[model samples]
Target chain A: DQQVKQNSPSLSVQEGRISILNCDYTNSMFDYFLWYKKYPAEGPTFLISISSIKDKNEDGRFTVFLNKSAKHLSLHIVPSQPGDSAVYFCAANPGNTPLVFGKGTRLSVIA
Target chain B: NAGVTQTPKFRILKIGQSMTLQCAQDMNHNYMYWYRQDPGMGLKLIYYSVGAGITDKGEVPNGYNVSRSTTEDFPLRLELAAPSQTSVYFCASSYRRETGNEQFFGPGTRLTVL
Candidate 1:
């Protein structure tokens, strides 16, 4: 069974619009969550992360929201640009354990 | 610094063949991990090492073995390759675990088994 799940396989957004990607987890032991963006033929790069203690964290145009009670998280990108197109993976880690990843969601930003 | 490096960007293996995928990191990290990503899927851990001489299996460790004789190197061995083993493999290193520390990943190695 998958502990973390990205139900949406793909998401498309127009330039200058907001994009949201959602993820859910079945395990309550996860304390930290992260997002990674991967371009074709390259390794996934770190995007942003949020701790279970906080409800939201923002960096520039990227924002991550965490809801511990719901066991859910979402990544938001404001004014999405074409350069933001890539595969995004949601990952979570329990204390003192390795990360568990969900199936990635492919984001397409049309300019 | 070359944070992490993997050899043989792409390879093709025949059934029953054996090979070792080499991974090295220059960041002097205490943690190293190996993962495999199938097409359109997220990465699944194969093996990991906390430090030199300390290695452990991950979610998917069947048909694979690993060794960490030194801090800078971790090698994954595939014994008796099978068709189901085809996938892209990645190597990553982090300063620590469960600290929200981002992992630095190397260019992946794509392998196909016939």
Candidate 2:
């Protein structure tokens, strides 16, 4: 069963616009959530993460908001750039257990 | 420093063949993990190691073996290749920090079985 899910397979946005990606989880025990971006033929790179204790975290242009009650999380990129185009995967770790990942959302930024 | 390194970027194996995928990390992270990714699917954990000589199976560990002889190396072995095993494999490592721990991944190894 897929504990973590990213329902949107693809998202497109204009450059310099805000891009929002959403994720949902079924396992309530997950305490840590992370987002990774991957390019073609390359391994995924870490982007941003949020702890269960905090509802929001921001790093540079990327921000992650978590809603514990709804079991949903989202990543927002301000003034999205063309370089931001890639597949983003949402992952969660439940109390020291191995991380579970979502299928991923492909983001395309049109210049 | 090369954070995580995986050799044999691409490989093709016949059914019943066996091979070892090499993974090495220069970051000196104590936690290492192996995951496989299929098309339109997220990564699935195959195995993991907390430290030297400490190994455990993850979500999808069947037909696989692993050993941690040193902190820098963690290799995954496929006893017998199957068509279902064809996928892109990634090796990752993370520090022991309680918070803000981010996993660094290698370029990944793509394996195909016929």
Candidate 3:
């Protein structure tokens, strides 16, 4: 079973606009959530993370929001740039166990 | 530092063949992990090690074996190659500390089995 799910397979946004990617998880035990950005033929690089204790975390142009009641989380990038185009993966970690990842969403920022 | 490094970036294997994927890290991390990524599916953990001479199976460990002989080296072994095993494999390492620790991944190795 897929504990983490990214419903959208792909997303497109214009430069300088806000790009939002959504993810949901079925497991309630997950306390830490992370987002990773991956380019072609490269490994996934950590971007932003949010702990269950907080509802939101921000880093520069990226912001992650978590809703524990809904078991959903979203990543928002404001003023999206062309360089932001890549596959974004959402992962969840329950306690000390390994991360469970979503299928990934391909984000395309148009110039 | 070179961080994490994986050998044989690409490989092709036939059924019943056996080979080992080598991984090494220069950051002197005590925790190491192996994961595989298929087409649209995300990465799945295969095995992990806490320290030298210690190993444990992860999400998907069947048909695979792993060993950690030193703080820098963790090798993954494929006993019998199968078509279902064709995928991209990644090796990662992290410090023993739990807080503020993030895994560093290798470039990955693409394996094709026929």
Candidate 4:
């Protein structure tokens, strides 16, 4: 069974618009969640992360919202740029354990 | 610092061939991980090491082996490669396993087993 899930396979948004990517997890033990972005032929890079203690965290144009009760999380990128186009992966970690990742969502920003 | 480095950006192997994927990090991290990603799939952990001489298996460890003799190097070995082992493999390292210690990744190695 997949502990973490990204139901959407792809998302598209126009430049300067808001792009929202959603993820869900079945295991409540997960306390730390992170997002990684990957370009073709390259390794994934850390984008943002949120802890269970807070409901929301924002960094510039990027914001991550976590709904603990619903076991759901979403990443929002405002004024999305074409450079933001990439595969986005959601990962969850339970304390010191290795993270469980969800199938990625490919995001495309149309210029 | 070369945060992390992996050898042979791409490779092709026959059914019974064997090879080693090399990984090294200059960050002096204590935690290192190996992951494989199939097309349209999330990365799957194959093995990890918390420190030199301390290695453990992760979600998918079959058909692969790893060794960490020093803080800077970790290599993965594939014996008798099979088609199922074909995927892009990544090497990552982190300072430690704190709640949110982000991992640094190396350029992946793409392997094709026929």
Candidate 5:
């Protein structure tokens, strides 16, 4: 069974618009959530992270909102740019354990 | 620093063949991991090492083995390759096991078992 799940396989957004990617998890043991972005043939890069204690974390144009009660989290990118196009993965870890990654959601920002 | 490096960016193996995938990190991290990503699937942990001389299994350990002889090197061995083993493999390392600790990853090695 998948502990982390990204229901959407892909999402498209126009430049200067907002892009929202959602992720859900089944394991309640997960306390730390992270988002990673990857370009074709390249390793995934860390984007942003949020602890279970916080409901939201923001960095520049990227913001991550967590709803622990709903077992869901979403990533929001405001003023999306073409450079933001890539595959995004949501991962969860239980502090001392390894991270469980979701299938991933491909984001395409049209110029 | 080179952060993390993996060798043989691409490899093709025949049935019953065996090979080792090499990984090295210059960050001197104690937490090293090996994960495999199949088509349209998320990365699944294959093996991990807490430090030199200590290795353990992860979510998927069958048909694979690993050794961490030094802090910089962690190699994964696949015995009797099968078609099911074809996937892109990733190696990652982190400074410590804590919440929100980012794991640095290698470019990845694409392995095909024919």
Candidate 6:
């Protein structure tokens, strides 16, 4: 069974608008969640993360909100830009273990 | 620092052939990992090591092997390549600290088996 899931295979948004990507997990043991962004032919890069203890974390135009009770998390990108187009992967782990990654959501920001 | 790097960015192997994917890190990290991403699928852990001389299996360890003899290098070997083994391989390194175990990744190696 998949511990982490990203139901949407892709999403598109207009530049300067808000883009929301969602993720869900079935593993309750997961205490830490993270988002990674990847471009074609490139490795994934760390974006943002949230601990189960907190409900939200933000960095500049990117914000990650976690609803532990719902086993759901969403990544919000405000003023989305063309540069933000890429594949976004949601990952989670139970503290120090290896992370379990979701299938990924391809985000396209149109200019 | 170069962070994490993988060699032979792309490769094609015939059935029954064997090859090794090289991974190296310049950050002197204690934790190193190898993951494979199949088409339309998330990355799956194949193997990992916490330190030199200590290696462990991950979610998908079949048809693959790994060794970490030094802090800077971790190599994964595939024996008798098969079509199912075709995928993009990624190498990552990280320090086990309070920084959320954020990992640094290499560009990745794409392998195709015929």
Candidate 5 displacement at residue A79 in angstroms: 1.2
Interface C-alpha RMSD after superposing true interface residues, each candidate, one decimal: 1.2, 1.4, 1.9, 1.2, 1.2, 1.0
Candidate 1 lDDT tens digits, A56-108: 99999999999888899999999899999999999997766678889999999
B33-86 per-residue lDDT for model 1 (tens digits)? 999999988999999998999999999999999999999999999999999999
The single-chain TM-score for chain B of candidate 4 is 0.97
Among all windows of 10 consecutive residues in model 6 chain A, the one with the lowest summed lDDT is: A91-100
Q: For residues B51-92, what per-residue lDDT tens digits would candidate 6 score against the true structure?
A: 999999999999999999999999999999999999999999
Clashing pairs in 4: none
lDDT of 4 at A93: 79
| lDDT (10s digit) by residue, model 3, range A1-111 | 899999999999999999999999999998788898988788788898888888999999999999999999999999899999999999887777667789999999999
**RMSD of every prediction:** 1.1, 1.2, 1.5, 1.0, 1.2, 0.9
lDDT by residue for model 5 (A7-27), tens: 999999999999999999998
lDDT of 5 by residue, B34-113 (tens): 99989877889999988899998999999999999999999999999999999999999987544476788999999999
The parts of candidate 1 lying over 4 Å away from their true place are B97-99
Arrange candidates, best DockQ first: 6, 4, 5, 1, 2, 3
List ranges where model 4 is wrong by over 4 Å. B97-99
Winner on TM-score (2 vs 5): 5
Q: How big is the positional error of residue B111 in model 2, measured in Å on the Cα after superposition?
A: 0.8
Choose 2 or 6, whichever is better by DockQ: 6
True contacts kept of each: 0.66, 0.66, 0.36, 0.70, 0.68, 0.68
Candidate 1, number of clashes: 0
Write the residue-wise lDDT of candidate 4 on B1-114 in tens digits: 988999999999999999999999999899999999999898999999989999999999999999999999999999999999999999999875544868889999999999
lDDT winner, 1 or 3: 1
- Model 2 docking tier (incorrect/acceptable/medium/high): medium
Q: Judged by TM-score relative to the true structure, which candidate is superior, 1 or 5?
A: 1
